[model samples]
Target: MTDALLPNILQFIGQIDPFDKIPKNALRTLATQVQITYLGKGEVIDLCTAEQEKSLYIVRTGSMEQRKVDGVLRAKLGPDDMFGFSVLGKDASSDKGYRAIAIEDSLVYIIPQTALQTLFSAHPDCAEHFASQAQVRLKSALDVVWSNKEKGLFIRTVGEVASGRVAVVTADQTIQAVAHEMRMVQRSSCAVIYDNDTIVGLITDRDMTKRVIAHGVAIDRPISDVMTHSPLTIKPDDLVLHAASVMMQFNIRNLPVVEDNKVVGLLTTTHLVQNHRVQAIFLIEKIKYAGSIKSLASFTPERQAIFEALVDGRVAPEVIGKVMTMIMDAYTRRLIQIAIDKLGPPPCNFSWIVAGSHARNEVHMLSDQDSAIVLSDSATDNDRIYFNHLAMIVTNGLASCDYPLCPGKYMAATPKWCQPVRVWKEYYKKWVSNPEYERLLNISVFLEIRTIYGNSEYETTLRDALHSNIRNNREFLSTLVNDAITTNPPLGIFNNLVLEKSGENKKTLNVKKYAINLIIDLARIYGLAVECDLSATDERFKAANSQNALSDDAFKNITGAYQFILSLRFSHQLEALKQGQKPDNNINPDSFGSFERKHLKDAFRIVADLQEAAKVRFGSR
Candidate 1:
């Protein structure tokens, strides 16, 4: 290759996979040994039988697919995706052969076996990424993409940043003694109350102030009298981001860090504020106290900034979704309070529950309002009026904050969705017992539900009813599998990508519909088949794995596929937001370079494989 083109090739390789792990000077040397060649759309490279020198074939641009000798599709390739790893090993045999076909006009980079072996000798660790197994390489690529030198503040684990000097006191100790212990520790905003070698309660400074001084209670009384019983605690390994959410959700300032049911340290608001690199915690605080919808709406810029920061931080997609969901919950709760102030206290007890992405805790920048209100059975017609009005204000208020309304009118503002507990139970029964295709589409969104506000028992009651009905309904899961398999990943003949034939999104792929949703549907189907009530996609798969419905490898591959595809969608959205354009799921095919295209193809293939598995698993019924 010419010197000028060599630099370009090095730049491309430097940003991708196992190559990214190589040292700079070594990468340039390796780049020098690469020979660039072009192949026409219908050309084929004989990987085993050809008399040419053995080499690693990396696609620099365009696309290709590998097929077994019997013509079964081995894998689809895009830019930065490499083949010929098998031949690089000393034990490779011609009997285990596959051929690469240029499904699209392609530019291929050929690295002679001698050069790669030499490079591997110098950078021994890099060899693992070139394992013949596609799973290993894909995992290596993920590790490279996720690892960072300067980690974000919230991404750190609680144990890494929390103070180890905790004040542990017996429940029988007097409040005066506990305060003395707190003073001695020098790290105490809260003290863990232990009894018989078990954590039984917790007491903070606020407890001393309110329960002792303000109430004129005797300080000589046992701390257990005022301590919070069975206090909520976070594990040492959980992210500080999650700790922050827990604090915000319950409106507490102190959280004891526990592991194996033993107190290790404490995470407080002080620690969170001290390490703040982003405004997520602050924005959530603002959302909580903001009295006016206009004030809440004005924080949209700050909200977007948090999203951008989380994406750039390379935090796990599930963690990012949780952080985003907490913020949304804050907004929703505040709006409900504002409505209550204007319309008077609620006429009856109710629970404001969310569905779909919101319920699954997988929300993103594009997530809309998928919620409903479950009223007390005692609610009257007058009560419905009050709630409908309340729902309108909250939904519109969410819109002003840039969370658009659900296009299908799934929000609580719709009377059909805002119903009493009995009606909600009936809806689940009819949908599960006699699912029609039209109702199947609607029920899929509500299959995962969570209560964010009001009487949580209402949610528990509804969930139990739904799960019971689902377990008794034999044909329900198969129906869901049938619907889910109807929309396959956009993989076509010769493993070429299928794109939108025409329209505004022409030549674009809907990653959500074609890839992410397919995995989610499979998780839900498998999750429910075993009576697993968890809402999150990853958790559902874990439940399936634990139940022996999915093998360990299948579970990991499918979940990894989900995370990779979701991250790509998030990156695509971030790009649009930076360009001052609206973000949607339809991603332009041309926008993906070889790196994204290759991994995306891998992710798509994983989803398609699981879809077939689901068909055999459930469709046989």
Candidate 2:
């Protein structure tokens, strides 16, 4: 190793964790074994064929792409990222051949497996840091793949696996008779069928107790009287999770598995629940128990587990939002608590306000954390001083937890964000009454706020003031509508998705910015105009369903568009996570299959239609 390279390596290590406590001689030993190499763009620095000599390579500049045996490019790695630790002593001919190719001219430092092990033995923190970063990237990409697989619409047919023996009853059967039969079969539910096996209805334990027994309906009457007619049925070939969704949505315990329009088998909530990957539930529980920052940081693995389950669970969009929000809120609150502890107790009570996805309780895997602070006005000078310090500590603590600081300086630590409740109300009133560009943008972010920690009364007051101002302001509503419509979705000439055109992200489509947020903005405006208290975009749309503010056609169009965009974003983020890269919304459209491209086009069309409708509604105002 060159003398200059040693200092650079030491400096990099210092940035991660200072090596001041290590013996000088041991540091020298580390410096001696390190090797540096320069790679030009498109160079293959490490191939599966070089599996005999395992080494960890850290990027100093530029990026690398990892690929599988089928030549499908998997992930892109950037500066300060490490890879190749998993290839040690593995046979080259094994199925797990991974290749790394440079994306641009770059410098990489290599550490042999033996040296890394030795270094870890002495400086465990360094090794843990590297491992944590690698795990985050890998888990993120895997999450994408898992989510896509779960959301894919290909239905599985029941005829393919039907055993031909299924519990069934005729509509003429009495509830008591069916209940007795169900108990005899050791099943909680059964399907009602006609003479030729056509599924006419279904009944479950809840149906028996709630509809028949509770109503004092004669149990001797036909089961059809108590059974749900035309119950939601799924084809056997449909995905198992699709049936699970039907169960969850209708609060039913059973589904009739149909094939060729005939009942072939029965599916129960227990089947769905049992098949669910328990790891996800475990992860959610662990996150709930994470009472400290250090404990929360250990949840990366748990987060990965949840990501994987979400993909595999194929949960409904609403449920997905709930699950993601739980983890995101827990992590954010834990980080804030850490910061508070670091800064000592606050001199006065304050509310930690989460904005954006976190605030709406609809956070996805790739979403960034956005938050603020609303201090109680009863604070003394000492309280202000203590809170300001606490805010910075909280912000930095979140950054360490993989939530990078907001590039727009909207974070809680910013002086503009950390304010008393009175200041926040004034900010809201000014934005609502006078719709300036910057003010409107700020208002959009603020609309999603939720109280994460501390006294929530301050948040309640601020929300009430915002709603009160918007309720009577027709002109302000129209201006907001115009602003919402201005996003225009991502539609291009001939109704194509307009992909990004600059820098390393060229040819990628920003699903979150161009597609999802467009729907969110429109929903926000509609909700505000109608005085809907819902915060989640989907919930807002549902709340506006009855109002003439949005026509039925427009509501359906926007809802479908939002779901399609969210599914795409979820898939992209999961893929990025699995590939050991940062989960993001920049997805290359060309990478999608023909069916996905078709759906994406349809989603964009829906957005465009909604935008046109908004323009028409507001232009006259």
Candidate 3:
């Protein structure tokens, strides 16, 4: 290959990923290995197997259509597009059930399998590109900044992924006219109904079917009559994960995105769940219909399967945490409903709440139940008795569904926790004012509360009280920071791993106590110090960094360390489960590879450095 030809190949393939990330010298070398071919229009290449045609095909000019043996169009390739990954899956246990053929007279570049394998081994990031090569890039496929495959394909913002065309109508428009406009326009699944540019409601195909087609509502009725009012909305820049979360959380398919107070895009669940088989959204819907705790328990194997899939795909730990939290949230909500069915409606308005990891939305397979109840001020002694019974049944139900009761008895079943809104406020006020041992413990665990079911306003009352109390008391924040700084990362005399000297997990690291929780504590301290109500560890850290409390290096180091430790801890627990052992935070240092050990130490050092920084900043309380 001449230098001029190599530069041409570099210019062509540079538009793609992994190749774009490769160093210029290495990329030039890779470009030299390419072999070019040409075909006439409507010509079919009998590219049967990897052994027969062991090369990747990249279209240089003209278009081509890849089809299955049975005649289904798999993908249409044009300039810069690549094909022939089906051949690479030769050892995939089965055929990919597809092949490529030419639709137009074209010039294609071919990279041999042997050369690609050598390059992939040389550059690990290139391997991801090879892995995703088999997936058909249909339309508007993007190469985004996402590094994990667990989210699958891309993790671009809603604005980037959402269809650019916004389908909308006024609330006063007739359903007939709305339906006509939908069919005449872009054939949308749903349309956002607005009132003078403010999004007021939404009408979906499901609503049209159930509310109109089934019930036979007049076609000329105002859209406001059947439209869902005050619909859930997402910001244009929000992550696609958040869009999936809101869709699954509310059991809706269409999500409208607002930007600058204008409805800009409507993203469907179809956009999110196209490639995934077992999404949190899908699982949550199943949990909702589960008739009993036993039925919900039956889905435990499915949960394990989902966890294994995410782990095997090498997704970020924060991604897994959010996914698992959705499952925990589903279980909590279902158990509450089961309790409600048996006990009938409560005597007064109340809120069912969850705290700690669940509230933070950073849960994992090993997280336990930390919860409470906030009742309306109108509740009487008899009402309290009813709520206690309800809480007991719900907690017991949750246990049956694999969510264990709180070890510290912080559950709603306890009378001290199942209190009226006014009493809960008083509790927070006293805890903040005192900052004693027990108070500190309780406040740390319960400070980040989230509403799960029932009247959310009840929880809002307690939340406001807690926020108010923290604002007036900076000493308590310092005290919490002081307490937080004491739980140092486990590094021994020689800077080796400090393993447990005794316990069931002897000679193992308690990752939760020593590292994960240490980060959590620091995050909580930072949150309180900045008066940031965010609960997720990464969010809290970022919030602190935004407030100029955390140095740039410290922010990056601590966040990276925290996520890596979480990933390690999750991997350990998952391995334990697969091996028929009970999973815990205890990870044996002997199991660590040289690579893991090195990174683990670096992560610990960051934790220690951050702790010292916090202690110095906050000082002794």
Candidate 4:
């Protein structure tokens, strides 16, 4: 390339990832070695040639398509998109008849293997982008988003933040001895009681005041007498967000960090309070004590604030989903309690369950209510009336707290969803046996159910019945697989542009309908085919992989794609919220910069490939 054109080449690649990650001086040198070439619309390049030297190709001016030996489409590439990655790394695998064909008269840039190696030598961080494994490349893409992040509470493990000032005592130790040890050793507020080598119990300062002093118990008694037996613990490797969840769920102020069955350190409310960023982690505690619906509704702003902090902290998308879901759970459970107080206790045993996104623990800013109730079989018609009133109160209260009512009435407040346990089992039996496309909309929402309050066994019984019915009906999965693949990802997103210029969805893309939900549907099919009971999308994919339902490479690529797309959706929603707009799933292509647009194409391609594979696998069964 002439030196005059080098600056233009530098500018084009500079805005794209991995190249953007390269140092400016090194990138200028890389640009100098680029070879510009052109291809006619029908021309093809043999990517797996035995005689040709290996090289990387980047489209500069027009579009192209890659294909395998049998002419199956591999990917669609547009300007700034890359190919020839299969031949870049040390463990580069054979393309096995894979080739690139220009769909338009194209201008392309070729980087010789030697020139690429020279760049990698100076900037090793950029080399992972060319890695043969899809997971490595996907991870490198995600890393670019957090490249500016300084390691903070969201990224640090529990071990990194926990205090090592835990007071360890034997189960046989006297209560007075344990208290003295706590005071003498850093004034630790909690003690872990061990029986020989095993952890037996945990005691807190409150236990001393209430169980000892308040009860007039002798101080010489064994500490086990007052300690909380089989207290919940967290692993050192766990994220602090997880520990925060455990503490909020159980209403504990202190938590022991245990690894290998040995207490190593302690995490307490004081430790969490030091980081203002974690204030949202403890917001659930406040939700627990809110006096009424109006007070609970006031926490909506704080919920948005928590989401902003989590995203700004660069927390993983799945973890962010979980944190948001826990807050929703807190709101639901608290609202139920408030309803009970107003309407009096239920006349019979029942379970208030959540379905769809809530059950999946995948709740986000745009998520609304998808819930139901399971009543005991012995309930009378009068009992039904009472439960119906309670459901109505909780559902409307959730809407007051910023969670919108389900547009389809798929809530506990809906008469059809509030049923006796046996009736729920009957619903599952009918859905699995028929698997009709018309009933799919309703069936899909309740496919994953979880109990949030009341009798837990009712939820378990429903799940067992559902799974049993699915296992016996082979054609059910085939029908689901067919439905899942009907909406292919927008692979032409890059070539034709990322948005529709006309129609009801003009100037925007419905990412939830076209991309995210497609992956969720596929995961559900795979999960059900293998009898996997997990509700979360990522976990269901993982469970499917373990059971050999999906190959290792397929599993990693699909899950990574799902995570990337979800993160983008969350980011889009956050930006809308910041701009004082109502959050929704419609994303404008014009909003995406070069960096996001490029990776989104890659993620879309991955989902498309997996969908094709699913059609072949389950369509035959």
* TM per candidate: 0.84, 0.55, 0.71, 0.88
The sequence of per-residue lDDT tens digits that candidate 2 reaches over residues 1-621 is 767768778766433222343556776687678788899988896456654477877777777766665675444555555566446433323436567788789888787878867977887644533342222322232333335444422222333333344557788877778888777774545645554566677777777778877889997998877777777777775555445444543567666777677666877656544545444344545554566766666777667667655745655455566666666666666666666667778878899888887777676665665788898878776777787788787777666666667777787888888888888999999998997889987887888778878888888888888889987676776887777666666533111236676888877777777788888888887787677766888778877777778766567657766666676677677777788887888878667653354345446656766666676766625
Model 4 lDDT on a 0 to 1 scale: 0.84
Tens digits of per-residue lDDT, candidate 4, 1-621, equal: 677898889989888877877888998888898999999997888776766678888999889988877787777788877888776665565346478999999999998989988987887877787676667777777776655366466556789889998899999999999999998875899999999998889998888999999999999999989899998899898778778877877878898999998888999878877853666566887898899999999999999998887787777788788778889999999999999999898989999999888999888988999999999999889988988899999999999998999999999988898889989999889998997765677789888988889999998898889889877887787888778877878775663455667886687888998799999998898888777777999878989899998988889888888888888888888888889988889888777776676677777878888888888888734
Per-residue lDDT over 107-210 for candidate 1, one digit per residue giving the tens place of the 0 to 100 score: 99998988988988998887867765445556766676677566576568999989997899999999999999997755588899999989999988888898
- Give the distance in Å from residue 303's predicted Cα in candidate 1 to where it truly belongs: 1.7
Q: In model 3, which residue pairs have backbone atoms overlapping below 3 Å?
A: none
Root-mean-square deviation of Cα positions for candidate 1 versus the true structure, in angstroms = 4.6
Residue 219 CA error for candidate 2 (Å)?
38
Q: Who wins the TM-score comparison? A: 4
Better of 1 and 2 by TM-score: 1
lDDT of each: 0.84, 0.67, 0.76, 0.84
Better of 1 and 3 by lDDT: 1
lDDT of 1: 0.84
Worst 10 residues of 3 by lDDT: 133-142
Candidate 3 ranges beyond 4 A from true positions: 1-161, 168-187, 194-198, 205-226, 235-251, 259-262, 272-275, 279-282, 492-497
